[model samples]
Target chain A: MRTCLIVDDSRVVRTVARRILEELQFSSREAGDGQAALAACQEEIPDFVLLDWNMPVMNGLDFLRALRQLPSVRQPIVIFCTTENDINHIQQAIEAGADEYIMKPFASDVLQAKLVQVGLL
Target chain B: MQAADFQFLSALIKERSGIALSSDKTYLLENRLGPLAAQRRLNDIAGLVAQMRSVRDEELIRDVVEAMTTNESLFFRDGKPFELLRTVILPRIVAARPKERPLRIWSAACSSGQEAYSIAITLLEEEGLLAGRPVEIVATDIATSMLIKAKAGVYSQFEVQRGLPIRLLLKYFAQKGTNWEIAPRLRSMVSFRQHNMLGECAGLGRFDIVFCRNVLIYFDEPTKKGVIERIAQVLAPDGVLLLGAVETIIGLSTRLEIVPGAAGIYRPVGSGPRAAVA
Candidate 1:
């Protein structure tokens, strides 16, 4: 079972994603914000990280940047989950090393495609 | 406007955003850029793009992109989901748990706090469910601006009416001109914060009833798998997973034994989590 880290600040988003993941058959972990996410990583490293873009106390972009800075933590494959649909924002996420970008209110099929696109599936 | 320009624009939008614009939205694109192009005295979008690349007004680039991103939100747009929460879900959750255990509920993509507040109103009404109890809701979102707004707990009347009932509007909220603020007591019941669906969920502990409704459908298959796996980790064994009306876990994981008689509910079959069993 692949252990995954859900990095987001919204509890509901975390819960919903967690529920979906449970249905998918992968073991999961969660963090509420970027700061907490980093801390969670220390306790138990995850196979993949689902990073959100906007947040307090370290947004997703900053978190991704910070994650790259640490050499000890084995980096997980990440996909940017956000509602920002601008070209530059998408390019920026890709530039920041995100394997893919997903929009908000997306259907499960679309999310699955993005996962496969990024090779995490 | 031209065939090639429209194709380029569509490709750019698709690449940058997952919104699948229909073929008839050509004028909508025109509307988005017309004012700016007119203000710059440019004859057309080509002139504007050329000028933008030359002078590179970074703010303009940002503004344009920001405008394109969809931030549309409303209070309780979907009534049936909340109906399930107040009527069917909460009762089962309370009955399944041991006494004195704190009830934790999460609202996944809590846009501007309305959904969380809606839950609060519903909880407040069910006196016996939480008469002398502790039930804290953790409301989170990925938008910083929205989180700030959610924390404020204020909304215009128009913002309130989308799904708010009149009884709730009168009782749990206070009038502030055209806007209404959810009562302080109701506001305090929820812990609002910034969260992304693609990261770690720490310090949140576990939840009995999770309202992660209608936030998925944006990720890829692997991301979905990864998300489900993580959710299973923190969920209490019998904890119920509530998804959007259109969402499901049919092709997903094996951890959750699909609960019979429930449309969108799933739970762990065996002993919940072995790590915490002892």
Candidate 2:
């Protein structure tokens, strides 16, 4: 099964993401912040990463840049999940190598579409 | 059926129900109406059409039209539009409405009442925002069979399983043996009626938000334009219209414009043609 790394600060958010990912038949590991996420990535690269924007100890953009520079050859398809929806923020996230961005409070359909767009499902 | 019978049936359907049927739909007619033919003891579609042409049987005509019109729908089908309704449209309308006036929503061509009930679920979930404001959900459909099922608000497990989230299924539904029924209170929030889209809509009154999704694609250009024109009349000045994800009013009507940042959502243009359908 494909593996996913979920990086989010809120327990509720992480739990919801995990449930949805697991339902999609993905094995997952979680990190509370970007530092932990980077460490996990260094240990083993996941096929997908559902990253949050506003976590402490290293924000999402910085972590994304660091993750890209990892010595590992495979690059996980990153999806940035956040409440920020303006054009500039979305553009910046795309430039920072996010495969897609979904607004918070999205239903499973949206997640499924994003996964399909990224060819993960 | 022969080509002549197919042509007659297509013309009859268009005139009766405003549904434009093309030659490609011969298979569709065969698939959907073949059993109706057997019940009527007709040899085939050609025989059914011959009987209808000869006698103009009203019941057979109704059955034929209803069968041809697709009623495929599910709870929360294509989730973004509902998300937009819950997050943006409802809050905007509530904040703008006067204190005493109740919010009105119409699910036009509401198939099996899932669209209307889905709207109710959203309103119920956002009770804190409502703050005692009243809300009415009016759902209308052309198919009486679908209306009956919609009014009952009951579904088989397989029906509920499609497009309905597990969390919502647990919260708003009660188990009836192997099936599930919508809670009485939630079912009561919506009112269903057997109203044809081609008929007068003034009797339904005005609505703040109208869900007319996935209904226009079946119509010819003229019928589609006519239906949308009538819809524009019954919509409140500031109200919005939500169409199917693939549908749009861009080429069909000039009175409505798509809302920026929201796909398939539209608002009426004040300066455009507002002439009533004669």
Candidate 3:
């Protein structure tokens, strides 16, 4: 089964994302912040990462930048999920190597479509 | 809400709009028409039916028909068809058509214009696919209210969120308070009009591509066949038709045949092998 690392500070957001990813037939691992997400990545790289923008210890953009530098043959497809909808943020995320980006408060259908667009599902 | 009333309303709606309302749609009728009844000062659906029978209120009938028709749509509702259009169909059409003749697309039953606008965005994003060739999009619907909203090109935040990628949303739309209005460049490429699928389509002229997705499922078998035949008439010999993912033309009309390896894409039958795309 494809594994996903869901990085978010809020437990509610992580739980909701986990449930939706489960329905999409993906096994998920949760990280409270970017620091822990980085640690999880070092231990075992996931097929996909649902990263949040703002968090304590390490922000999403910082984590994405750091994740791209790591020495590995298989890099996870990063999808930046956040409440941020500005063009500057989206451009930065794409520049930082996010395969796709989706706005928060999204439904299951939206997530599935994004996944399909990224060829992760 | 009674059986007889339901039958009468369903029959009336089917006759007027070619939308078949099955028996299980009782709750749908009540849910949609309930507020309409209250607005007209009727107690319930039963009273609404009686009003319809007693007097020939053309406006009231039009309102009821509009209410029952589903206008639910989203940007890039299904990703595959649009992807196919970008990679396979448009390239072939652009290469085949003469530069003097502009490419024409018809979005039949386009609710609030998302499909047509999505098509416009696809073309715009292609950069040099059209080169210097012109393109035109004609979007039509049976509901005047939908056409009005479509022409305005304004969408609520919720409406824009569904099936619309964040990047494209940021690139193509400008924020207006809580809503987003489409760019004028994209708006100008498409023209919105009120049209019924069952009516004559020859007046609209021939189209290189027709998007008639999702609407035909509401029609009965006979109605579906008639609409398809009419579309076949207006479809250019080398044109393509896109239907809903689950919709099929089998057992309906022989004027069109499915394009092998392409789901939901059809071409005019015996139109020569030039219509096929790699």
lDDT of 3 at B25: 86
Candidate 3 lDDT over B1-278, as tens digits, reads 79999999999999889999999989999999999999999999999999999999999999999998999899988878789889998999988988888899999999999999999999999959888788999999999899999999999867887777767887899877667899999999999888988799998989999999999899999999999999999998999999999999988999999998888999998875677353
Q: Which stretches of candidate 2 lie above 4 Å from their native place? A: A1-121, B270-278
By DockQ, is 2 or 3 better? 3
Clashing pairs in 2: none
Candidate that would win on DockQ: 3
Which ten contiguous residues of candidate 1 chain B have the minimum total lDDT?
A: B269-278
What's the lDDT for residue B88 in model 3? 90
Interface RMSD of each: 16.8, 13.2, 2.4
Which runs in model 1 stand beyond 4 Å of their true positions?
Answer: A1-121, B1-72, B269-278
Positional deviation of residue A68's Cα in model 2 after best superposition, in angstroms = 31
- Give the alpha carbon lDDT tens digit for every residue of B1-278 in model 1: 77666665555554433334455777866787677778778887766666655775766554444344345555554565566767776676666666688888788768788778878888888868765668889998766667888899998644654555444556677766546788889988999876656566755778876776666564556656666666777677767667766877777777865556656666765744321111
Q: How close is candidate 1 to the true structure, as a TM-score?
A: 0.54
Give the runs in model 3 whose Cα sits over 4 Å from its true position. Answer: B276-278
User: Candidate 2's residue-wise lDDT over A8-98, tens digit each?
Assistant: 9999999999999999999999999999999999999999999999999998888998998887888999988887644456568777888
- In order, the candidates keep a fraction of the true contacts of 0.00, 0.00, 0.27
What is every candidate's C-alpha DockQ against the true complex, given to 2 decimals? 0.01, 0.04, 0.42
